[model samples]
Target: MIPLSPEILAALALALLAGLVAGAWPARRRLLAQAAEAARQAERAAQLQDRVAQLERDLSAQADALESWRARAQDGRLELAQLQAAHHEKLAAFEELRQAFDQSRATLRAEFQHLAGQVLEEKSQGFSRSSQDALGSLLRPFREQIESFQRRVNEIHDASVSGQARLDTEIRRVLETGLKMSDEAQSLAMALKGDKKATGNWGEVLLERSLQLAGLIAGDHYQAQASFRDEAGNRRQPDFIVRLPDGKHLIIDSKVSLVDYDRAVSAATPEAREAALVAHVRAVRQHIDDLARKDYSSLTGMKSPGFVLMYLPIEPAYIEAMRRDRELFDHGYRHNVVLVSHTTLMPVLRTVATLWMLARSNEQARALGDQAGGLYRQVEMVAARLQKLGHALGAAAAHYNGTVTAVAGQRGLYGKVGRFAELSAKAGRPLPALEPLLADFEVQRLDGIAPGADHVPETGRADAGSPPGAVPEDLHPPGEPNP
Candidate 1:
């Protein structure tokens, strides 16, 4: 080969370098793509692992729930078994009771059939000669008794008939009298309706009667036609003034007009009645307003309530007024006027009376409490004095015991006697034997004195034949004294 030129060699080297660079780029790109694929596959595997873990956790929770449900089901099965067993036992008992009842019923039926057959046989046999005679003897008294009962029943029937006739006559008379009384009452009502003063008087009378029925006396509980001056110096006379326990007065006015109410009641046509009813309602409202304007609380020397009562003598008039005006009661209340009938006022008066009674009882109780307190103090003082007396008695008993012990000592009277005797013997002149005196002056102890021991000589006093404070001859140690 000829010697290669430098340019040719350089061109060949460049071609080789270009071809190597191109091949390396393809290999690097393939490696990068492989790495990216491997990363994606790893990420997918990690997500699948998380999903598997979540599924396992869910399965675990489901298994735990299934276990719990199984436990509950087992418990339910046990309870159902117990209930079924109890039901079986009850069924067995019921069957046994049914068999027993059937047996008893069959036995009763057989016995009844036998008895019925015997009765039929006896009935078919009819009465024998002796049985018939005996039966006739037995039935004779019954027959006589039945005859006497029949006679008594006939007498009672006759008497009842007469009495019924008399009762019917009396009933007719009573009916006639009732009708007459009703007519008279209607006439009186009409008369009352025509006269305003009379109507007021009637209402006052009814109020007084109601108060009396409620255990309230006229002068003691209430006053009639009591006049008082209002705040505007207007002299108003209420039908009645009831006194309460608190010194408060309830003013009651009974001069309400009833003419429209009477007209409403007697009206023939509905329109006329409605008109009269309206008029009645208007009259009542006017009366309520008038009474409210009176200002009864301003009465001098009397603690009157803010409200006044508008008294309606008749119950029918009151009912009609209320029926005509549905809001009449509310309206009256607003105006401080209370409308009341005889029937309604009775309870109010009774309540007032009860309040008074309670107040009186309270006063009595207070007085009794004060007296009891004083009595308790006196009792305490008495108890104190008794305690002091007991102490003084105890001290006296102690001093008496000490004196008794000193006087009854061994070296006391007996020792003195013995010394005196010795001195007498030394002087050649023995004193009369004092032993006899010592014997007569023996000491005795008593446990306690009997209740009626005044006749017995006291231990501190001289006996009939002994010295002072000496025991008697009949007295013995640890024994009862001779009577």
Candidate 2:
């Protein structure tokens, strides 16, 4: 509002010019900085573009490689599938071939076994027949027993071969039957739970069957329900009395009750079963005690072992009893009682049968021994007679030889008989030619004769032409011609 002089105005103009120059310098510096920043941004953008192009190229190459691998993988998969199919077919063929081989092998084995059995049987029969024939005259005393023994041997051999062949089948059948029987037995046990007499009868039947299976005859090898009277006149009847080769007895009694065992079998719970088992064991123990009191070993006229056999009809009952009471066997043994099931008793019966066979064999051998001794004595008598006959024959031969030497010597009857033949030339038989033996002739003597025993000196001369060593004419047979 109060502008005064030109100098003041000039000063204001210089200040304004300096301010505009400062502003223009700042603007130029800002513009140059902005241009450098824009250049760096563009360079950065170019580097980014180059990296994107390289990444695109790499992606395309990888796609081509992946396609090549995929094609090879497809071919490999096809080849693998074909190989698997061939392997499976070959494996199936091998299985069929193996099965056929097994069938052929089995057929061959059966045929071989059959042929072998037949051959063995034929040979055995032939040998037995021949032995019977050879020994028939010599073994007159044992003929019947020998025949019986031979028949038994044949029966045993046949049974053995048949049993061996059927053993596998029998074992399988037994296992299957045992399983089935176990179920049936459980049911039977339930039915007979309260019937004491029925259970005893059942046990006795099984015991008899076992004896029969072991080749024991009822009247011979064993007796059923054999009654013996004790000292007190008590009629003690044992279910079976098995006879041994040594004339001893095996007493088997079938009196065990299976009622508690049946209860155990039908128990509804673990605790119930446990209780029933305990009761069953106690019942078995009680039965053992009762059987032990029978004292079958002390029966009159019977040679029995100390222990009596207590037979159980069911195998499972025996097994369960023993399983529950591990010391049950020792317990029964201490009480002179033996617990036996069918399976266990079979071996004892078989052993008894074997013993009987061995005893029969020993008896046959003893008879043979006695016969052999008699035969040896007969041979000695025959040999002595043969020696005496040889001595007589040797003496007769020496006498005949001496008489022949006397006649056939240079001074024998032939020399004088030649003149007689000339004298009787007209006789019908032209005098049978009498050729003397060679002067160096030899006479064979009996091998066993003593040196001088068979020699005989000529007693007297038959004719004047006879030699001094000639035997007497009376010693020669009347009908015999001169030597």
Candidate 3:
């Protein structure tokens, strides 16, 4: 037991209080550390949950991609099956056609052999030694004629080279201007982004001229420079709406892609060329995207299908760029844009016009054939009537000749040439009467038709049917009257 003095009791109680306080402080600190550890564990649990959620999301995306791949594989298998079936059907049909062709060929061969045998047997007697010699003589002369014809053909070919070159130069000159203007038209379209009357008029004129150069008329063949509204209420005006011969419309967006090409051509170094080429490729890709978004799918009134005809106003360089970098062009086709070069468009336009012309020509030929049939009938009737006409003509000619001779002997027409003719007769047998007619009859050189073509346009009658400004003296025979 402890002493119970006032001071010592107080001291002992104080010491006990100190010891208790110290123990309680250690217990409180341990409890606080445990609470902090629990908080750390809770945070780690939250992080693990987040990581699990992320992995699940990744797994879902992969599954979706796998499902898409399976769908594509199924579609491919179906296409392959259909292709195999079509191929088998085509092969069977081809075999049937082959059999039919064989039968027809055999029949033709049999008929030919039968005919040949019959002709050989029946004509065997007629084709004796004398006849064979005559045939040889005739064939020899025919070979000479064929040689002459071939020589004339060669001369004609040699003469035509100049004309072909001239025509090519003329055509290229005319078309080059249009190509230059097409470039300007592209510039004009870009300039049209700014609101201006000049831009508007320029756009219209550019489109109109392009249509005309493409051998089209606006009212008849196309509708030029039509405007459409975008979602932003801004007006979009395309350059050309080429109406094909079948009255179908193709929207043409002319883009100028030659700037980068020009730079590349003028580049002073390989590095420069490479830079310019890369820039040009990007520009072309951008152009494809721009031309693709021309509301072609919606405006053309087709969904999931549309043709965007991009008109590059340059030469084959633009087309070559696409060929060199196929990825850029693929960007275009992904959007259903077809990049058309000047050469391709020119032939396409020409073909379209030629087809139209052919259609008209066919119609004209049918009509002309009908008219020609009627003309043939009329000509046959005229041939009968011409017999009577010939009799009258002969009578009139004789009368005229007699009258001319009498009048000439009256010392009026023959007085001028009488002295000269009498002197010529004393010179050489009176210089035959036909010599004067032969001197005036000029055989026109058909130089315009290359060669081998005696296209003597109306040269038979020297007096009535000679070319303009032909010689007048002795155009008719000396016995024939000019009247």
lDDT of 1: 0.57
lDDT of 3 by residue, 171-264 (tens): 3543456446645644544444534455445535544554565556667666666777766666777666666555466777664455666566
RMSD to the true structure for each prediction, in A, is 41.8, 31.3, 23.1
TM-scores, one per candidate:
0.47, 0.52, 0.34
Better of 1 and 2 by lDDT: 2
Candidate with top TM-score is 2
**Tens digits of per-residue lDDT for model 2, 192-294:** 8669999888778767866775668899999999888988998999889999887889989887888888887788865677788799899999988888777
lDDT of 2: 0.60
Say which prediction, candidate 2 or candidate 3, comes out ahead on TM-score: 2
Pairs of residues clashing in candidate 3 = 425-430
Q: Model 1, range 1-483, lDDT digits (tens) per residue?
A: 799899999999999999999989989999999999999999999989977976796577557545643554465345435534643553344344333333433443354344334433433244367854664464354345434433533443354345334433532343234224334433556676568777777666666766775667788889997777767777877778999988889888888877887787688865787798799899899988877777665678767768888887665567567755889999999988888865456546656765765565445334333432333233233233333433444465566556555555565554556567665656565434322111111011111211122343332233455322222322222343321
TM-score of candidate 3 relative to the true fold: 0.34
| CA lDDT, every model vs. true structure | 0.57, 0.60, 0.50
